[model samples]
Target: MDLNLRHAILSNISDNDQSQLEATIVDAIQSGEEKMLPGLGVLFELIWQQSNEQEKQEMIEALEQGVKSATAGS
Candidate 1:
């Protein structure tokens, strides 16, 4: 079994510049489709793996706020 989903996803976007990467992430998230989850998970994994402690905390805070706001608005 040779499944390398993360590598495949990364390789597909390796040549993308910062703006392109941002657009890719934003589009995937904004679409709100279940099929887009794997790519988003890969992106999130990369971000988490590369972030420092403070950055991780900030991300967690932002995620908490987003969840709270989303639920409250519903």
Candidate 2:
């Protein structure tokens, strides 16, 4: 079977409102299920594509800090 996960994921959330999207993200993260990772990646891709340069830089910094913190705690 040929599956386009990104397209499927995007279609699922395309009509979400702000609160709905926030809840979807929060729920996915809190669930801590590996299967949710791809969906989160797709969401991040959408955000990255739409963000301005400064926003992208901010995201990169935040991600770097998160990675550092995660590794530090381990």
Candidate 3:
């Protein structure tokens, strides 16, 4: 079976409004299901592709901080 997970995930959320997208993301994270990771990755991919260099740099920094915080809390 040839499965395109990215396409499937994107298609599922393609029509989401801003609040719907936020709710979906929040629900996914709060649920902490492994199945949701790929969908989150696709969302991140879209954000990354649309971001400017400065925005990308800021995102990287934010991600680094989040990782550090998560690690420290563990």
The per-prediction tally of clashing pairs is: 0, 0, 0
lDDT of 3 at 41: 87
Better of 2 and 3 by TM-score: 2
Q: In terms of TM-score, which candidate is stronger, 1 or 3? A: 3
- The segments of candidate 3 whose C-alpha lies over 4 angstroms from its true place after superposition are 1-3
Q: How would you encode candidate 1's per-residue C-alpha lDDT over 1-74 as one tens digit per residue? A: 12497788889899999999999989998999987788888888889999999999999999999999989957
lDDT tens digits, residue span 1-74, model 2: 12588889989998999999999999999999988999989888889999999999999999999999999957
Per-residue C-alpha lDDT of model 3 across residues 6-64, encoded as one tens digit per residue = 87888899999999999999999999999888888888988999999999999999999
Q: TM per model? A: 0.83, 0.91, 0.90
Residue 53, model 1: Cα distance from true site in angstroms: 0.5
- In terms of lDDT, the best-performing candidate is 2
- Where does candidate 3 clash, by residue pair? none
Task: Tell me how far the alpha carbon of residue 67 in candidate 3 is from the true structure, in angstroms, after superposition.
Answer: 0.8
lDDT-better candidate, 1 vs 3: 3
Error of 3 at 50 (Å): 0.4
Model 1, CA-based lDDT: 0.89
Which 10 successive residues of model 2 have the least lDDT summed? 1-10
